[model samples]
Target: MSDVFDYIVVGGGSGGAVMAGRLSEDAGTRVCLLEAGGRGDHPLVRTPMGTVALLRTRLHNWGFETVPQAGLNGRRGYQPRGKGLGGSSAINAMIYVRGHRSDYDGWAAMGATGWSWDEVLPYFKLSEHNERLQGPLHGQGGPLWVADSRTGNPLHQRFMQAAQQAGFALNDDFNGERMEGLGAYQLTQKNGERWSAARAYLLPHIGRRPNLQVHTGAQVLRVLFEARRAVGVELLQGGHRRQLRARREVLLCAGALQTPQLLMLSGIGPQAELARLGLPVLQHLPGVGRNLHDHPDFVFAYELPTLDAVGFTLGGGLRMAREAWHYLRQRRGMLTSNFAECGGFVSSRPGLVAPDLQLHFLVALMEDHGRRLHRAHGVSCHVCLLRPHSRGTLTLRSADPLAAPLIDPAFLSDPRDLDDLVAGFKLTRRLMQAPAMAAGVRREVFTAGIETDEQIRAVLRARTDTVYHPVGTCRMGRDDGAVVDPHLRVRGVHGLRVVDASVMPAVVSGNTNAPTIMIAEKAVDLILGRSRAHGASMPAPVGAGADVPA
Candidate 1:
């Protein structure tokens, strides 16, 4: 096998898949994508309902657990990251949310140049091929497929109705003119199957594109640098250590957790941390793994007698069999459900600049990310703090590259986060009590009989965990502490860049997968030195000023 390539992409996750696909489109650029897990072609990955199987097993999941969080009564949080070709997209719920426009605008405001809503919207449109909604805000003929849920579950509409009855507006499109109302989510699916990043971008052109090489089960150990410039990567592939040289660049797309870990392992982190670990420091960038944050989420679970809700019971088992038959025959059934099918963005309090909390109404009772199962029919409402002030760290537990990094999200460490969550809990409780939902509700299970601010605070402290959108470790900004600059080039280094969720300056207002994909779409232009006509005509400087809300 050839040892040299024009570009070496680490981690075949959302960002790496996009990078490998787009860069290799030139035909001249040889791109090598290394994935730590298998090809991710299992049936459990393709079937939408199979997310349950994938989440329950460690086959294709990293399944990393965090250090006991002081904010959550010293309880550890579960983090299930996809380890295969498609990464988390393969195992994720397939909800397609681009987050609020204000999210990107805020990034630009924080000195992440060329990342404002106006500047990055083109990229969002560029990567999307929406099967239903299309116009200025969306695009057609793109690689990624975006479609509405085909499940046609009554519970989805019920959730929307409940939210509206509770006074929230009905929004047909969250990615359109407004993002503040409840609605059914679009999904990254095609023909009732999960169309993960690999399916959308990499898998199609695998054998077709000779310049593109994909290696599964190749775990990158470290970036090999010459003086200051990254030149290659050392990886353990097929039980043998292999060195592959990158003639041009090494792109780290290992998502939030591992990207920073890889950087720190490669001697590109805080000097003191490296010294304490007795590792040689290649570059002392203090921001390598700092500014770690995620949406602190709490689920309000309930039990119901209605069979309309999904659960594990004799009746539910029969329903699943029928749904399976329906899926196999027509590709439309409850099996197509993403579970968190309907949700919305809202403020915890009135008249906020933007929504500080987001809701994800589920068709089934989800406790501990579906890890805990109940035998009765039920439902759940997930409320998460959109912009958490609490921050944490990702540090090496040991010098071993194979060991999991120490993840401390410090959820609710900021007292304000607990306050926001309390307000959100009250709002969600009101929504759940709406006529549409109250009709089917039997009893509240999680925070039952909980009332008053102190009671809510106690519930939040016990239940608050990640909504799976972790970012900002290798933050992009113009500040010296920033690990990557506005262009995503690693600070104090050349021929190296971070192109993933880890580069987000702050967590977005909603689901993060869509925004991460958009980052890669825009990153292609930045890497190739090509100016996007859609973005180039904008009047604002990339990071000059804050965007005034219209």
Candidate 2:
């Protein structure tokens, strides 16, 4: 193993895995990937139903919690970040969504040059190997494998039918011409097993490419800088402090929360904050942690007397045991369920350009991110405001790199966000109460009998938290407040770049995993200075227009 490489990628998460894999494709270049967690090869990580165990336990999760949120009546929010080779992708629901076309176009409009829908669609196609869908919108032979969920639970179809019964259209493909309506989600899986970013990009090529080095349980303390240029990284591995140099560049792909925390810890944050923490300032970038935001979500749960929902009763336990055996033999059954198997995008009101709220109809009674479980068979539907108006900040609680950062998403700080969520709640309740869904429902369990707008607002304040899509901390744009520029390079530094979800100027309208992977795919070209003409290019979706203000 070499101490120095052409590219040193920090945090072997979604983007870092892609970076290491793509950069090392050039046999001439050497790449090193650092991960804070273990190899993430546990059977729990490969099983879709294992998501519950992963989130509940600290095995592969960072298990971060936010400061008490004023918007949620001073309740601390739970944030479970993935720790290991694949990062959050290894622990996520496996839903493969690329957000709406407007999301990328809006980025270009906001001065993130060369990131329009037409410009970025190629990267999305390049990263995906969709088994069911094909054509210009999807790729066939790609690293990331995406397939329809293999869960045979009839409740998934019932949720879709219920949405349609409530006057919503049934959309077969949310990633197609339209992102509006109800349907089953395409998952990042192959043969009923979870297919994470590491699985797609790094694992297959590990020993085959000697130039690519992946080190797990290597925690990066800070980026080492010579004056204003990032030269290497200081990390702790095997109870020993060590340093690794980057011959060309040091890429930070540590996702939203940790990326900003890393920058601040390395003295590249607000001058006052750094000085107060008794840390010398390397470069003052206030936006390193200023634009923090996530989709504030509320879940409506109901108890049902049916075996279709996952539970812990005697019958349910026996059924799960049988399903486990079935999964071992056929690789399909209840164990193949990604709990939130079916969902959709829809608007709370008419005349909206795109859906303002996204729904995840789960086949279990989920509350507090499934942390607090119910002993009965039930179902849950999550409604989240897609594009929130409120913004928050991430600051260091202490100079200690191991200390959790001060996460304040300030959810619903803007009055309009609350209003939008109220509308979304009413719409979700209507779908849950529709004839198709009502037939399976024994009774409403959470937020039941809440009809008034004020009551709904109260419920939101009490229950709303993150739906796991956190971005925009290290914003990318051509503005004074932007932390990274259009090319994802740090504003006041050289030989350094952030190629992850943190660089998003605004949160996308859907799941962020696929979009983050796309960012890495496009970043490979930028880092290598390759032209779009040489990469996979496709015509823009018909009727897709210029960017609009988000």
Candidate 3:
């Protein structure tokens, strides 16, 4: 392989995979993709149910932890990021969601020009190949596959029934004309297997495209700069230090947490902090790691008598044998379940511009993010504050490139977040108590007797953590403090762009994987100086507006 390339994409995650794959499509362009993890084609990654093991171990996970959070009663929070080519998309629950249209419009409103709902809608359609639905809102013949959940679990119907009984509307498609309703979420799966971003974009063209090279287990130390222009990257691969040059541009898609850390390590963050860490300053961008935020989530778990949901009861073990046999034969059943089989978006209070609270109804116990085990069948639901007022930071834990970054999500730092979550908790509890759900429940694990607002607040502080959607650490805006420019180029530098979740000025209203993919799709056009006049010129369909906020 050559030591130089037209483009170098760091971190083969959701965004980098797309950037690398699309950029290399031009036969003249050479692309090098560097990933710190593995190839991401293991059976564990392909099987939807393998998320249990993936989340619990470092097998295919980064398994990062946060600094002690004062908002969560000083407890450290768990952050399990995917550690392979597909990144988090390899191990996520596979629930495909493009956040409310207002999210992108709000970005353009915030000075990220050409990123409104209408402007970016085409890229979304361009990236997706919906297995069921197709319209102006959804694309066809795209690489990333989106399909309805294959789990034949009866609990899906019960959850929908319970939502309707609780007076929430049922939405057949969350990514369609409306997002405010309860329903089953589509998955980034195909024919009952996980179809991660790498599976969709990078892996297929690896050996076929001689111009594209993918190097896994390559840990990037920092961006190599010629004066102020990023020219290449210094990485550690196979226990050897190597420097690969980029002839055209270097794209950082290392995700929200590590992207800023890489910037700070490369001497492009707050001057004082860089000096304090004994690193030279290239640019004093204080906002490199300043706008960190994620959805603060609380889970409600309940124990049920039957073996319908996933669990470890004696009867459930026998059922698992049958399930395995059925899965091997037909590729369906509980084995195909993403656990978070169904979810929804809804407003925490009336008159909100968009759904402020999102719910992921699981047919299994997700106690401590599935770290804690139970011997009984149960159900779990997660309610998260969609757009949090609170923000946090990701800083260098040490100068060591291999060390984990210091993550302080400052969750619920703004008391209003807790207030909204309290309302969301009450609303979710009501849904659980509805007749459809109540009939199967034997006991409520937590919050059984909690009734008052104060009690809810206490439990929330005791249990709230992240739903794994962290973004905006490398914020993009026209403001002086923005880390990257509107086109995602690193300010004060040439030939460097960040194409990942980190560039989001505000976190989206739902699962961020799809939006992150959309960002990469839009960025490919920006990088190549291609006009949106061709395939990506579709406007947002009628009635695709947010239910509340215009």
Tell me the spans in candidate 3 whose CA falls farther than 4 Å from its real position. 532-550
lDDT of each: 0.88, 0.89, 0.90
- List model 2 lDDT by residue over 168-236, tens digit each: 998878899999999899999999999999999999988899899999999999999997778999999
TM-scores of all candidate predictions against the true structure = 0.96, 0.96, 0.97
RMSD of every prediction: 3.7, 4.3, 4.8
Q: How displaced is residue 28 in candidate 1, in Å?
A: 1.3
Q: How close is candidate 2 to the true structure, as a TM-score?
A: 0.96
RMSD of 2: 4.3
What tens digits encode model 1's per-residue C-alpha lDDT throughout 1-550? 5799999999998999999999999998899999999897788898888887787679689999999999999999998899898899999988888888888889999988778988888898899999999888998988999999898888877788888799988887888888888888899999999999999889988889999999998999999999888999999988899899999899999999999999998999999999998888998899988999999999998897777788999999998998889999998988888888888888888888778888888888888888889998998889999999999999999899999999998888999888888999999999999998888577889888899899999988988888889999999998877998877888877888899999999998888888888899888887776755364433433332221110
